[model samples]
Target: MSETFAGKSALIIGAGQNIGRRIAQEWAARGARVAVADISREGAEETAQILRDAGTEAVGLHCNVLEDASVAATIDAAEKALGPLDIHMNNAGILSGGNPQDIPMAEWQRMFDVNLFGMVRANNVIMPRMLERGSGHIVNTGSFAGLYPFAASRVHYAASKAAVVSMSQNLALYLKQFGIRVSCLCPGPVMTSSPDAMKHFSENYVMRAPGSHLSVMTQQQTAKVLSDGMEAGRILIPTHDEAWETLVEVAADPDAFVEKKHREFLAGDPGRPGITQDVIDSIKA
Candidate 1:
């Protein structure tokens, strides 16, 4: 929101991978003492090394978000290593790509564990502490897919994120009095793993031009956007500015947007939702 970072201690779960790693770097560059946490200690250490190379104070810790003890231990380790936690990024998540109904029960539960309950788990720890201290921020990673359950391969993934959105919204209201802010980053089609599958799925689930796309933004672009958006204390941080237009359009007249989008779906265009596979892939590439 104001982009304050100097002398702040921030813990980012899932800090080993692309988006999480980039966020760590960005925060480190801003002089925040970072806790690069992941399910694997080695991955976390690697990210910490990257931060250390840049001369930032950081520690790598292992925490399985699905387990309460593991999550608690990681939080304690982070606070011990990084000093008091002023910002907590609940970034741990899994992307299960495929039809929802056909997904294995194990996979579906895992999706909820990381994408929804994991977020809640982290927040349950950090937020109470924040409220007690009377000031803090919890940034949750959501997705544009959450906004509309596009008939993508990752239907469960979308549902999980939708839960995150709803949770963050309520938490925002609940934590406002404590001076603790809660925000969710609902970005569209980040260029991550499984590109072809993402593209194939986006064909029907998202809106996009044959070549143009709105869901995919550069990592750096999104990083910058996320940084600014978080600092601004926004509840929903969307990358493409025009995304708000669509959101507003949909909110004002859901029936119309649904009608138009459904028509596109029936016509087999599959590119009228929010993004295209090509756009998503190119952005990732």
Candidate 2:
């Protein structure tokens, strides 16, 4: 085993499946003791078993990001099992897709609760400990949708992820004095294990530029990209080349980028019509 992460301990929320599972495995392979947490106890145990089979020390625990008690208990359990955490990966999130007007207010709230506020909860519980230790790293999972607003139906999901990006940026700045680092992993469409999820993403959330190709990476590939970014201490880890380019373009010229997107929306050639003006007006009302 590599000594890169030797003597370190990691806790990955949502580690039971897909990209999160891959990340947990990667961390373990690099010599870190790991805690695999998920809403499903069985899933978490399965992931832990895989790591143990590979000669890594690991434990599985149930964690529901929507519940405060669950988050606290999971963190406590992880520490008890693996010692004080040196790396925290907040990877718990859910996808929400629908026309903005069609989505209920409750659903929007739920999305925020799980995708954004869940991260807030984790940081609240973990940052102080990390600060006291004076050495730690936090990796928050955002998304390409958050970096570029292309899917109108995924407005809630994008908003939640964008908040994560902002939160990671500010946390990086604030935690630097404490010798702690923060990274936001923003991956484009990744091929998950669930075909239903992939189909839903393809039909509702995938976005592309005019005449540009859409690329999808497997979970392992996404995990490798994120691991590389974290190793390099990059604050914003965009897994795809096109996502990085789009972000750079938007940063260089916000007005021009919006104008171009508007033209694309009008032409019906690029971008998805996520919500209508009527929905916006109604929300304002």
Candidate 3:
């Protein structure tokens, strides 16, 4: 393992499993002590155990992003165990799907609480410390849905992620003078667990992009890309090349992109027969 990050420490929220677990492992492999935090204490401990087994310094912590005090306590405990944090990653989020009309306002708030405000809560605590030190890296996990409004099924998730991207970019612009780096990771389809996991995720969590196919990457592959991107000081990192390419297309001709996206939405989902063309058209109007 490279000692590039040796003597450094990373505090990662949502590190129980999936992409979060992989990210914790990635940093640990690169020679950083890691604090693995998650809503599930067992999950966090499991991840920490894995790192320890691999000869890495690690600790498992329970952190509920929904609670302000839980987040504060976790960060405090992490620093006490591993010294000051060199990297703080917010990877806590809930995956949910529903038509825009069907999703209740309460549901929208819940989604925002986990997917958006969770990062906000952490930053509220960590940013001040980083600013005081005059150095730190903040990584926010977003989704490609944030960059493109094509995930018709996950309107709330997309919206929350869009907010994350916006916040991350703005923070990067402001924090540059302070020597603090912010990265927004917008990944496309990723097999965070088993190969079959993607299938389960597709059916339950998000709708596939219309007229575009995505290659699902493994957790390790996604983590490696994030590690490399962070090393290069990239503000925006998309795991899939296709996601980046689509963003370029959208930026180049937004009108065409919007029209194309709506056309796809209007076609309706065959699986979700409740989503009719009329419903989509009405939403557009």
Candidate 4:
């Protein structure tokens, strides 16, 4: 309806559901041709069909961020269907919870492979073409946990996302001269399709902080915030007030703030359980 992105083309990895799917829909509504890529072919097709039904040019492609070949193939397919990409959203990620010291090496590697390395894989394939075009926007989805060290159980996830934040910042600085913009969307808790994700977050992360009041947004609401930020050319898209405040506090006094939060977390959950198969399985869904 807005047509702000008329004639633009976007590739959204992880567009099968949740925030990624919403972003794809929003971009198509704004008149951009979209490629919805996901590990689930059915999900990707469903998203693309929804866009097509709305009179938008859209395609569905299978992509597993863990595989470099898959990433390259998906990019090729997207470009073939939607023309050259003007926007790239690396939104695929997995969640894992446990004490860093206790989580398995394999699980840690898996988390990094999907959450952090997956971003690298997509950027590696798409950034050069974007550079050659002399203009593009790359939005990497990060987390509030990445900004601060508050979520003790989500160590692997937070670490991977923190790397993403750092990578996006450096990318913005490196590519600004080339007419490319990079942004890190660091949002607080959002309503996800995972039935128990909200409950887990409420019990583990949100309520752990005594006076910290963080609002949870629906997927559509979060998508709108990110879309607005990307359109406005913002470098760091902080979607929640609490996350912003935490970022500010950390920036002002990194050591003191981090130490205080670490103490608070330990004080609140002294008996936090170790990484169990059920805990891992819960997040897998």
Candidate 5:
């Protein structure tokens, strides 16, 4: 593909580790100057150093998306260091898991505070600037769970991501006249961490069945998908082939699709892990 991103300036929040870091690397590889922002100062600097070593103009900044002041400061520092951003992406989020009934309201609110409102906060800061400039692209990290009913035990997480999806699409409609692009990146499961760590997370938190993870891609692989989708100007970018296929199934027969997934959940299928009181208590503890 042609270098669509060359000479552009990009800012990625939550670029300290995993998918966000990989996406930042992808931007640099495409010849864009990048700012790596994360809650972890060390991780942000480490990512920035890696990009700098590779000869990319990059800066590391501390950005806690939950805090308005932090978000404002990070964007200001990045723009001062690297020029106005051509692309701004919000990738900060957390995954919490438990049965819907077992999870507390506080936990649900916390998830929204990070997953959905984090993007809202960044957009509130960046979108006005973009509107004045008459050009910019915004990417919000969502999950496939938000797009479908696949996440059996993660009701709160799914709800938060669903809100992200809604917000991104609507924002796209409103921003199109101003030449601002919005993309909601919804990927199924990317192996941003090691297998052991992911397994531990699933067992203790998500209650996902062992061997249930299918079509898991590396961060590089997932980033490539995102890059291609963004280049194509796709508003809703889903990484997995199965995600597309299942969405089609759902569209064709909503009742049947929901029924099948419900059955799978009840039957303790691969995606729907066996849930027990012990798992719920562990999550609570």
Candidate 6:
């Protein structure tokens, strides 16, 4: 909508901790009515308390994104408490560890349920109202993995995020005529929970330089960029400029990005991991 968040109503799903909480705090600072939803009642209450302390209109609700009923009820609660939804940020996500093959089916399913279906559920509830209102903004949380499929570390997570990209693009096109905007925030290594995130982004995914190719953006930097991108109605918000640059390069010549990454990986780039050679050599067993 507008660059100003003053008087805007924002609904943030999974807004209890980490990136989600930070976004809520930032949005509140900008004078938005904040509705915090989490699977944990206490967690949502905690975030709502923080927002209220800042004098922002705040509401807390427990929502399980995997459940249709819970998601529907959450939308009703948010509108009833905070007014019409002006912005919806789908940031609820879970990251899995190890190779996908080595992981269990149940583990993979749950991760997608939160990260993928969570977005689906949020849009399912919010998009209709947005369409009726003839104006709204949707920002879905994706990852760099959605762009680069070589992320063997978390295949299911990557797949879920890729689905997010597709959904976002489609929605952007379908809703553009009605003034509804859909954007995807594909961030690299954010400093969220150590376990909920892939290893703290090291140098492995970068080019052959200490501060080149790829780098992790601090959470605050990320929030600001995302906020700005949302205001600009950017369809794909890449926190690291390299991601969009590489995508463009790949579109022109696929081998350039691949060969560069292979050369960097072969050059002993740690790539967002803090592991030393000794730690790398040691087995978890």
- Tens-digit per-residue lDDT, 1-285, candidate 1: 135677899999998866888889888887788998998789899999989999999999998998998998899999998778999999888774654446677877887988899878888788778888999988998887777535355777778988998898898998898898887887775565534433222323333321124555556566777888877778889766766777787788888886876676667775533545664664444
Comparing 2 with 3 on lDDT, the higher-scoring candidate is 3
Candidate 6: pairs in clash: 201-272, 202-271, 202-272, 202-273, 203-271, 203-272, 204-270, 204-271
For model 6, the superposed segments whose C-alpha errors exceed 4 Å read: 1-4, 194-212, 273-285
- Candidate ranking (lDDT, best to worst): 3, 5, 2, 4, 1, 6
Per-residue lDDT of candidate 4, residues 65-119 (tens digit): 9999999999999999888999898999888565556667787788799988999
In candidate 3, position 242 carries an lDDT of: 70
- Which candidate, 4 or 5, would have the higher lDDT against the true structure? 5
Give a tens-digit lDDT track for model 3, residues 32-109. 999999999999999999999999999999999999999999999999999999899999888766667777778789
lDDT of each: 0.77, 0.81, 0.82, 0.80, 0.82, 0.77
Q: Estimate each model's TM-score.
A: 0.86, 0.87, 0.87, 0.86, 0.88, 0.85
Candidate 2 residues 1-285, lDDT tens each? 444367799999988888899899888877899999999899999999999999999999999998888898999999999999999999988885666666677877988998889988888899989999898999899987778767665677788888999999999999998899999999776665443562132345334432235555667777888888888788999877777677788899989987887777677666422333443342222
Which is superior by TM-score, 5 or 6?
5
For each candidate in turn, give its C-alpha RMSD to the true structure in angstroms.
4.0, 8.3, 8.0, 6.0, 6.3, 6.3
Off by over 4 Å in 2: 1-4, 193-211, 265-285
Q: Could you tell me which 10 consecutive residues in candidate 6 have the lowest summed lDDT?
A: 202-211
Error in Å for residue 131 of model 2: 0.9
Q: Which is the better candidate, 2 or 5, if ranked by TM-score?
A: 5
Instruction: Provide the lDDT at 87 for model 6.
Output: 90
Candidate 1: list runs displaced more than 4 Å: 1-3, 149-151, 194-212, 272-285
